[model samples]
Target: MIPSLIRMARSRTYAEAINLLNTCQSNAATIEAIRKSGGRMNDYAIVEMNDYLRRIGYVPDDLNKLNVVHITGTKGKGSTSAFTERLLRTHMTGRIADVGLYTSPHLCAVRERIRINGEPLSEEDFARYFFEVWERLEGNTKTIYPHTPQFPIYFRLLTLLAFHTFISLGVSATVLEVGIGGTYDSTNIVPKPVITGITSLGLDHVAVLGNTIQDIARNKGGIYKAGVPALSVKQDQEEATRVLAECAEEARTSSYEVVPMIPETALGLRGAHQRINASLAVALARGFLRAQGKEGMDDALPRSFVAPLAGTKWPGRCQRVEQGKTTWLLDGAHTTESLTSCGEWAWGEGNKPGVLIFNCSGGRAGQMLLTALLEAGARTSSSELVELGKRFEAVIFCTNVTYTDGHFSSDLTSHAIDPNDLSQLATQNQLRDAWLELVPGYDPKQAHVVASIQHAVDLVRGMEGEHEVLVAGSLHLVGGVMEVASLQGSLGMV
Candidate 1:
């Protein structure tokens, strides 16, 4: 083992463990491997995942006892998982001891990814579980490729940790969200889930999953298991719908159903787009109950379901934080479809938008994201255009780096970004130029590109008066904004 891995395994505090965990993430190497795989990455993903799971003392079959509701999609997967977990927690009260939720790209802390009964694992528990997995993997001496790192990467390690945490906690039900595409995601090692769900599909993650919507659908459908009931939100694209149906058939799912949108209801998560997710969650939750021989609730919105759905608290997505004079609107909408919904939600919050803080991960289409937001704003406006020049008093584009010191928080550190791009502010500059071209009348002076999320927040804070600050684009960027802006308090109910 590497000396650092030994020290990381022996971390005494949650903070220390988090720092150590961050070091395990080999994003650059992972990207390189993916590139070299030539689109055949998914073939080996599960075989390797199973080996990692076995190294930590579990098998694919062992996870079946967790009664998981596996969920995946290009967008809305997190929200859908949140809704499903919340609903199950409420509906299964007393009947089930606890519910486990594991999602990705946590907003504030790494512990947010693993929750028990809607609460993030306490720092003590997180540290305890972190070391438990670390020690197990370190003690094991098995490897398919001895040259590769002995330990799994950050996400795989976390997925193993989540499984260990849930099983150790004796949780009866678990909601598992895919970290990436479905078929090969670390969470896909679950041999059987009570039910599986897919939210709205889009062309995100095209490079790895394939550039077409059909490819994305097939990659997502990898979550579907034989004899499992599979459900998805009604897709807008006919190609996606057809592909998903075919995938379900190929997987031999007990049944395949498309969930229709729920009428505008009192949902805890904001945005019109959430209704789609909410509808899917309802189906998954209900299907889980039936699969477990708990209850067969009909399509009608029962009080048990309604209350949890209303009280569901998904932080950082369509959230509004009121800190004195500033009303901060935060949504981690990285894809164009989700960003359009985010834009609509922002416009609905207020017409007099204050500052727009935006940043997408490297390689994403910044202009397309901006266009989605602007187009959504245009639809809600009576004018011909959303008048980007006046709508947003100022537009700030910045890197996801948490601080101006050119460092990321331990949990927020990302190695996937291109080093050259980060040094040159390449993506930020492109976004700025895209904005300038999109709104020609907009004053160049009003547009700013900064180095870090802290710089963006500082710029917003330096501005005078109370205004609505809309922060959207990448979830990492949103998480950075929450950290620097001290909006962590709004993680529950904003």
Candidate 2:
């Protein structure tokens, strides 16, 4: 035990821990193994996640002490989680001592995934807790099962670490965001939460979550737990609404309500779509407070809620960074509906043609995402931004690889993408070709396929005039932009 403790305390820096975390990401082999497992990958996912929790020295019931507010959705889930955390931290002063937030697909740093009091865990803390969980898994590998590989995958391990960290820190409330679909996501191992929420639903991760909109709704609604209140914003499709209602009943939620959009008020996060997320957050916070026996939880918006809402900051969504002559508009909108919202916000915010830096995952339909963006821009009533042909000065497609050296920053490493696709620049080339076909009279010369994100930034930097640059499609791409352009300062990162 002394030797094991010493090994855990060995020279494990934050960087080294992050590199270890990167190794667990789902690569081709992981996916192929799941495919050969003979059913949906998610079939026994939560069961395995539960076992992982126990191996890490906790059970599903142990998470209940954190008083979690589990949130899942296709689009605005992260924003909703952010708003909920801020609301609890600010409004529930004496009752809720501390608030913890855990969200996914972090923009710049992995530390951003777990936060307390709205600040990410310090690097020292992140590493200390990361390896504690790591050693737990490593120590038990031979005992668990000899046939199956040990150590949970990237997201699962992170989830386990998050649970351990939150429990150890004694946070009073936890705003947990689902990494994928609600039902089988690693985060869903929590047997019960104080409340659960579903933000506006859309079709995303169809290959893994489900195929149709109803399937997507059912998967997201899986977060609804028996005896817990489930809240959602009005979905666009009635079929989705029906399916979600069914899920709530099936889960035996105490009550399932479709929350109305919050009154138009100042919001820290930009984009009109954020209002939906904010509204759901309001309901979840109120319900959780009531469950905690806090009084003065009125139905109407509280005076204390206003400031936190306006002050809330979820970086990388509807974010703008002004660097010299270039104004950068960045949003991680990969889905079609989200791209439409992104386009509308871009045109409404700056009614002028700009350079578009875009790339999507290999599996996504690039043309559809591009169409949603371009058509939304064309529909913008602003006369200056009305012409579809004039909407973009140039379009660039580049891999999410951070630097021109063909390497990823350790914190930004992703193994989910295909190695062959990355080597061939397949996704970028497809996006470039899609742009040419979509825009009539678009000069092929104006559409470029670059090998690295730094190349795209270099092109924008060398442009002759003041340019507005819109970076969208992938959060990984946005993080690469933030790294290459050194725009972390804009997001108030050190």
Candidate 3:
């Protein structure tokens, strides 16, 4: 049953594979087919994994041969994954083979989710593997999961695809970023990884992971397998340490290492948070090498591999661009916590006021961000700061971030708030009105709305001023700005 499904899945084109899967609405049959072809995860109890593997003809034999690095957290997962992948590439040898990197929420393309040494999977490769796994399942069986039964989720299938692709490609090491909560996340299929790392924990994905830092930390910590070396960034140190310690004990963890993060690093990527992320990646890589009996592997890996990260290019995180005489900063700080931190960072002590261009999705923590910026601006100058917040001389409200339909589209007219209008209202009223006005379609419940980020960029480009432009909200938003800037030759053109 599994072999036939594999053949069928492999025979289709990339588009066909996607269409077939989409047609099934991700039913149990599709999932079962995926499982038969080698899909496994921690959500299934130990007994379930063993049973599924046995029934599906998966031996879990490759666990010993593979070097797996699992990274989980609310934020900085991508940066950490990229950093770790790059460092490993610099050190490891043997044909200098491929490294598997799996990141979630692909910005532009589905293939972006799975890359081998920074290149997306070839179309033929993706199609071949899709069928290989599909044919391996028993009688093309499908199982109905409780929750939304609308086809197996795209991420689930993509996760399986990544695993199979990594194996087939003979990748020596695979760095996986957990899609959502770690415990039940699809990527938890790997029995034991060489090392597990967690980036900073925040209050996102509240519905699935739970609210509060500790709750989310516990969920992310689920990626830590028994006896596997685990490293984490500096978080709510006391609470995080305590929770991780408890988890380590329960999992019979071999060694638990905490990265001693320096607040300041020479890394081009700024923000105190990035320092912690870099430290976590460095410590995890060190532990991974040490476990592989490559301890003190200096010559094998370049000193620059673990050197203070510089020239790191992560889109949407304080990315700076210059157009003409204006300095345009782009960041995708969506959550309140991230936005507030970014706001404070932007309005650093003795910094010059500039034009602020921003937008937010429905139910986004925009109010908190506006408040933070206002407070930061207020501290700098009683009148000028207030005026800066009010006038926003070059403010443009546009959308091109994460949309409900999983596509980039924004409606500027909807939920548009003029900075000038905001300035006149009392501080508290301004915040309230801004929050209400920014609500897309004046509907807080609907997550779908449109805002064109390009429009905002055009507005900025058209403006005549020596002012710096600050673009913040979502990574998707930042990516748009970068894309536009790149096309316009405006990146660092100042």
Candidate 4:
């Protein structure tokens, strides 16, 4: 029954499979089946996804048979991946050069994670690939050790699915993004990558990754395979230089050669930080070309790659939109450092009076971010900073920007107060008063909490104002803002 369901799901029948599961009676065997065969975090190790190539009877006879550029970092991984894919497609012609890109935390659709030449995988493709992988794992439940349905994790399944999809599709080159820390990431199964790229390191996911910069760097740098070329765009030159040096030394001694592929100038993305990202991409591309013995094959490589870097556009990173007299700028700067940098870049060296629509999840350093934004000259004396007290503005307008699980949606809005501020607003009246006071001019008749992010964007669009609508909060909000603006035909204006 489980095998059939898996097959059905793989054949673009996900809805049926899900419905069947819900209606089926709970049984130890059924649960065991899901536990054993379903996706798991460490399943990559148990399943040994790399071995599938032989089992499926497809073998690459040469080292140059497949080109892989592995990119991992704290930020800019998505943009770098997109830029690299676009550049390669534009330059590498006539070979049906398919570029496989896998990014994390989709903006609106899960299909957005996997792309071929800048286009996302379609819904049918996702369903088809998902079930195909599941079918392959069917009847081999015993092969999985200490199997637990919840243990292997969904992300592991996605990783294997991506690899299988890329290979089956005969992608010439695949750009894989490390889901988390690189060394143990499932994508690490790829053998002899053309280049390994790293983006700027920051303090994030502290509980899982590490508490300090070096600790995080060590984990991220784990993806640097021995003997493979590498590139990085770390801003703290000394820290980046030191970390890369250490990684290089370790890799060299272990038979892996590491090379510096920093960019010489800024690419298309905004902020000085992006210049580093472009550099990393450039370094990786150069190494890839050299490894393929295509170094001098095209004189356009240098110019073509560099030219696109400057004009390369990525949504939610200081994206701007104008509606009538009002200008909307969306940025997903959740951390203090990122917020400070973004505010500085947006407002420039001088202070500007602006309206800031801000909100944050529980664990983020919101207070610190607020302080940084204020110091960076973001707040106007008249601008209101409405912390989501008890009754936050009910309708949260989301622009198809990036978001996280910790972000507030209708499900968690009631409990979405800042963890640090939860103690202060214990009383109902206090919370209500705080919420009401935050909105500046509260009109309950016009107030309603919205479920969809697009609704909030529409509301903003209908408003009439010359003031810049600075959307500074989470990536989810930024995405929502962009999607709404795009719908209104104002996206490219940014």
Question: What digit string (tens of lDDT, one per residue) describes model 4 on residues 310-347?
Answer: 65665566666555666666677766666766766566
**Cα lDDT listed for each candidate:** 0.83, 0.82, 0.60, 0.55
Which of the numbered candidates is closest to the native, going by highest lDDT? 1
For residues 122-174, what per-residue lDDT tens digits would candidate 1 score against the true structure? 89999998898888887886786655467777888899999999988889899
Per-residue lDDT of candidate 3, residues 38-67 (tens digit)? 233333433343333333345556643558
Off by over 4 Å in 1: 32-42, 95-97, 204-210, 349-351
Candidate structures ordered by lDDT, highest first: 1, 2, 3, 4
TM-score of each: 0.94, 0.92, 0.72, 0.70
Using TM-score as the measure, what is the rank order of every candidate, best first? 1, 2, 3, 4
Off by over 4 Å in 2: 1-9, 28-40, 94-97, 142-147, 204-210, 351-353, 381-386, 492-494
Q: Is candidate 1 or candidate 2 better by lDDT?
A: 1
Model 2 C-alpha lDDT per residue in residues 1-494, reported as the tens digit of each score = 34644453466789878877876788855655442332236566777888788787887889999999999988899889888998988855654338888998887889889888888888999999999888887777653344345777888889898999999988999999987777778888788899999988775445433367876788788889999999988998899899999999999999999987777889888888888899998888889888989777786576668888998888888888788898899999988888988878888865454799999877678988888888887776444322564557788999988889888888888777688998999989988877877776778888889988999999998889999899999998998899888887655311
Error of 3 at 188 (Å): 1.1
